[model samples]
Target: MSKAEKTRQLIIEKTADVFNSKGYAATSLSDITKITGLTKGSIYGNFDDKEEVVIAAFKFNAKRLRDSMDAAISKEETAYEQLMAMLNFYKTTWKKAASQGGCPMLNAATEADDHLLFLRDAVKDNFIAWQKKVSTIIEKGKAEGSFKVHLQTETYAYTFIMLIEGGILLSRTLNQITHLNTALDRVKLIIDQEIVN
Candidate 1:
C-alpha cells in the first residue's frame, strides 16, 4: 500500500476498538489522534472529519468480524456443517467480542438510535447485509434438502440476529457469558427443530 493508504489504515485500525468501546458519540477527534498518534491535521488529512473516521473505523471493525466468521464457515462443506460452523463461531464469540466492547453492529445500532444520526444509514445497511447473509445460508440449506422447504428464510434469519444480538447485550450488561450461551442454545434448537428437514 501507498504511504497515505497505510496511514489511513493505521488510523482506522487503531481507533476501531476505541469507537466500539467508548461509543461513536462519545469518541472525539482527540481520542482518535491520541490512539493513532497522529496530529489533527494529519488525521483530517486522511479523513474529512470525525464522522468520516467513525464510519471507516466501524467498517474496519465489521470487516474483521465478518472475515473471521467467513473463515470459520468456509471450512465446512455441507449445509448443516456450514450452519453449525456459524453457530460455533458465535458460541465462542463472547471473548473476542467482549474485548472489543461487544459486537460492532450492535454497538453502532444502539449508539445510532438517536445520538449518531450520521451513522444511521451505515448501521442499517450493515444489519440488512447481516440478515441477508443468514438468510442466504438458510436458502442454501433448503436447496440441499437439509433444511425444510416450508421454512421462512428471512424470519429465521432475523430471529437469528435478534437472538444473537440480544444475547450479546445481556451477556455484556450482566457480565455473564451464559446469557449469550443460552441465546445461542435457542439458536441451535431452532436449527434442529424448525429449519432442519
Candidate 2:
C-alpha cells in the first residue's frame, strides 16, 4: 500500500476500539488523536472528517469479527456442526468482544437507532448480510441431510441472529454471561428439536 493508505489504515486500527467502545456520537476528535497519536493535520490529511474515521473503524471491527467467526465455522465438517461451532465460538469469543466494547455491530446499531442516522443503512445492510449467511448455512444443511427438509431457512436464520444479538446486548448490559449462554442454549435447542431431522 501507499504511505497515505497505510497511514489511513493505521488511523482506523487505532480508533476502532474507541469508536466501538465509546460510539460515534460520543467519540471526539481528541479521542481519535489520543488513541492513534496522529496529529490533526495527519488525520485530516487521510480522511475527510471524524465521520469518515468512525465509519472506517467500525467497518474494520465488524470485518474482523466476521472473519474470525467464518474461520471457526469453516473448520467443522458438516453444516449442523458448523452452526454448533458458531454458537460455541460466540461463547468463547464474547468476552474478548465485551472487553473491546461489546459487539461492534450491536454497538453501532444501538447508536444508529436514535442518534447516528448516517450509520443506520450500513448497520442495516450488515444485519441483512449476516442473516443471509445463516440462511445459506441452513440451506446447505438441508441439502446434506443434516437439517430437516422444508424448514424455513429465512426464519431460522433471523431467529439465530436475533438470539445471538439479543443475548450479547443483555449479557453486556447486565454484566452476566448467563443471559448470553441461555440465549445460545435456546438457539441450540431450536436446532436440535426443530431443525435437525
Point out the worst 10-residue segment of candidate 2 by lDDT: 50-59
Alpha-carbon RMSD of each model? 1.1, 1.0
Please report, in order, the local distance difference test score of every candidate based on alpha carbons: 0.89, 0.90
lDDT (Cα) of model 1: 0.89
**Stretches of candidate 1 exceeding 4 Å from the true structure:** none
TM-score on alpha carbons, each prediction: 0.96, 0.96
lDDT by residue (1-197, candidate 1, tens digit) is 99999999999999999999999889988888899899999999999988999888888888888889989988998778887888889877778889878899999989888788888888888888888888888889989988899888899999988999999899999898898899888999989998899
**Over the stretch 1-197, how does candidate 2's per-residue lDDT look in tens digits?**
99999999999998888898887889999888888888999999999987788778878888888899899999998889989989999999988889989999999998889988888888888888888888988999999988899998999999999999999999999999999999999999999999998
Residue 190 error, candidate 1, Å:
1.1
